[model samples]
Target: MIRKRTLRHFIVFVSVSGPICIVLFHQTSTRSFLKDSCMCNCAMDSEGRSWFSQRYKPSANVTLNRKNGLLDFHTYWWWKSLQNESVVANYTQVVEVMFSLFPDKDHYTDSSPSRCRTCAVVGNSGNLVGSRYGALIDSQDFVIRMNEGPTKGFERDVGSKTTHRVIYPESAVDMGVTTHLVLLPFKILDLQWLISIFTTKHIDLTYMYVKPSIIADRNMVMILHPAFIKYVYDSWLQGHGEYPSTGFISVIFALHVCDEVSVFGFGPTKDGVWDHYFEDFKSDPNEGPHDGDFEGKVISQLHQKHRIMLYKGW
Candidate 1:
């Protein structure tokens, strides 16, 4: 009878203690795993000289060969069937334009200077209206502006110096020969439009009457690789929305090219209104095809991770 009682007691004790032990072990293991993982990731990010950097270098040295197979050609170009058709029909022309316009070398090299190259990604958010970030934005090595985010009247808020301007056909603006026109081509026609503008000045219709020709330097024009766009779309955004926004892609572009990046005039206004500092259009800024909320979250994550400094101007 005592033996039976003891057996019952032991069984109950085992049943009760098993889960507790497992829970304790899981908690300890999770903490240890997180600590080690964080250390590894931080170390990798600190070096900034890994295969990730080499693979995604923001320059024209990225070889476009058959083996690589135009991985991102169809990403944002067209619908599934149309994308395949476009790639088959216009791949060579698109590539030819890219090779002809940009240099054949990568921007940064192993022998490049050790000093940090600061960049300012100036968005057109209404928060920058009276922020007086002009001087601070101009101080960076590279000042990247998007669309028609002008600095003429608002030079006190948005810097006048622009090293790079990211634009597509719809939001195209005339830039100086000194500024690099980083073309974010969403479709094959966008590429054709650029070529025609630079050469024949024929094609001229995008949402609005875009300039058929601009006064930009032929050599300074750099087309963003579709693969790079896809990389940003898939990796950083985890395939969140229809496509990545021009501002978001421009930020990622800066991350590859500059050692330190500072973003200005992003997000909504102080009063939480989504409108440009330059103009108040009768459309919703956050109602675009791109997921603005998801992009904002990613931007916040980048700021939190110390990869980039976000000047909210709030």
Candidate 2:
């Protein structure tokens, strides 16, 4: 099992308190776009740099207060984001209060130039019905599962081991003590929710009503840096989707922390349907804020560049 020291988060400024908008994935069926997804176009960016470049900062995480309580002002831009009604006044105070309970430590101390920590980022695409990828997935040094994707009976295809589970207030579940409950705090209220969940259990509303508490290891909880989310949105997807999907963000996250990453349950299914493994949809899957087509292209670029080995489940 991989042990975590400090897990800080995504830079979120406001709360999505109004509504949780569901953007049905708009499929891009153009041949040119499909080819782009297949080809290793490393020059997709204007700078003409490869996604596999060592220049990419793995420590996208911002350490607000260092060992001596010194602040990194340069990373302060992380708090800039799409504002909403529930804007926070003193960001530092709110952050420090949250850190008072959750320790502020860098999780990558286990990282080394000599070490190779492989990770398996499991998605919930329906194509994994019978691929039998369980053994391969569990064999990795880290197994990252996102949202509510289950591994109980489907272990034969999706694997049962989970080192981390990335979720938001609405998507949260009863996680095991061993697995890291990575929180996607898109707003200040989200952070408040994190603190409340473990202590007072006072928070029970966001864009939708949420569980005040969940089963998780307080020590192992991690937060996704909002800057990291912004980074993926701007750099990787080129501002395509309203924001990056948890699955896409998980892949980018793996690239930053893991030495060798093998992605499973990405892209469309064998039937070309964009859906999850646990649910049954009669027609096309409901759309979300993410641009499913653009995300696919970027993933294809990463796959072609040899940066990641994408396992499009059968």
Candidate 3:
């Protein structure tokens, strides 16, 4: 496992009131644009780039603080506060585990000035059942898929090329060694599970029997910053849902990473059914913690604003 001394500085503990708060040190330098007053638009201003872009965009250089680490103490304890001993222990364990697995540096960086970068954010909506969008999706410079959106059995509608996969322990799956495993940690336990699976093979429980270990490029493995996730929840969705879904987070992640972003397999199907293209069972939008309807509206708004291109394949 690759280790870096600077990884320890990624997260800093501060005393707030009486309890300890985990402050994401890197995000302190950046301004917060997700405040309620600035919810209207993400347009660029004369001052410089839009706050949304500046806040979420992937850094060109991988400095120690820029690497994936918990930055916000409030966000870290948003789901569960550190008042509980278990929570603090879990947070410490996760930090240690992450440090052990932290890459020497980022693998993907900004493309050269001469090239135009395009990315496809593919979901598993049943709308892609017969769209035959495989070739178009594969042609992009990057193809990002979320959860267990498969291509082996549904290549005609969904492309087979997967450059990056945004997932958590619950929705984890194995991928080619060349693909990047972008872990979207919802909580401290999620981060612990990710490191445990890869290093110790002790975590085998989730929604299903998760693979104790996965085969993927360690250098390319990326973890989404908790602050970034909070930004999407507060800025992009305006706190509409309990939390941003993995698919929604992936779209926002692509916005920062790719110059041109295209979305597919989101929203309801032709018959107004919520289902995955690779599965026959129907998905209930209300079943999960996410507000699917609100997310759909936000996605549509992004498309209208020209921030993203939504491909609602019939």
Candidate 4:
């Protein structure tokens, strides 16, 4: 706990551009303050935590600026996503308007700096079965689950508490009133889709039919910056696979926000079968287009380095 310490401010880099600086309400500053802080698209105040990778630092702040300017156009991921004429034509205008509906900063990090936030990133791997991690997962300060992983029937394995759900349009489901619907926007239409959910239900199609609106609090909605997504792909993954999977993205997201992160149900089982804990086990081929083998190894490496705690249910 931070005792009666003098509150001091520091100049920190919150933008990927590296020029923008903001004064945050942190208690202390060090020579390594700027060096240790996450300088990605969003702002972070990791006073009590330490990270070893330069690919990106640990930051709970996900969104870069109030209005993120543009994704790195050089990457194929950026250029390819911009193909939609209507979506891309008014991308800037759309984002500015949509951001108005949500909180500018991720409220998770708004708590007192002395409090150590512990997080649980529960994956959908079949290994979660028989682990009895429900009680443990629910105890976390924040619990971030990904995709279509359901918790109603399997609360004994996967906890029922969900603070954030990382999902794209195709995998979206109506979450609890308090849970944040963290949208992983693959394209501009995804952004439009989210806006339509709040306003007009006109965007019924985004390569497939999507939920017109969900039973979520519009104030709790959050979107990841494309630049941060690209950073995880290019820097962390070293440009592996077509793009980063939602599972990996969620892990990275938790790392930024939580001082301690615990991951569950991530890799294949002992028999090497890949399936969700909720689904019947089958000798399913590794889920496409993600490089599952590589990602699993990366998760293990992060665990080995003590950056995160990986719980692989036997």
Cα lDDT tens digits, model 3, 183-234, are 8876666666777766788968644576778777666778777767777777
Model 4 residue pairs with clashes: 41-64, 59-256, 60-256, 60-257
Candidate 2 positional error at 2, Å: 52
C-alpha lDDT score of every prediction, in listed order: 0.72, 0.71, 0.70, 0.73
lDDT of 1 by residue, 1-314 (tens): 99999999999999999999999887655544533222112323544334344334444322232333254545545323322333333666565765665554444443233345678999999999889999999999899999999999999899899999999887889998899888887766777777877788987875458778888887777777667777787677777777789999998888777667899988888888888888975346557568888899988877776567899886
Q: Identify the leading candidate in terms of TM-score.
A: 4
Q: Output the better candidate (1/3) by TM-score.
A: 3
**Higher-scoring candidate on TM-score, 2 or 3:** 2
Score candidate 4 by lDDT: 0.73
What's model 3's TM-score? Answer: 0.74
Q: RMSDs, each prediction? A: 14.6, 17.9, 17.3, 11.3
TM-score of each: 0.74, 0.77, 0.74, 0.78
Which stretches of model 2 miss by more than 4 angstroms?
1-51, 62-83, 87-89, 282-286
Estimate the TM-score for candidate 1.
0.74
| Stretch of 10 with least lDDT, candidate 3 | 31-40
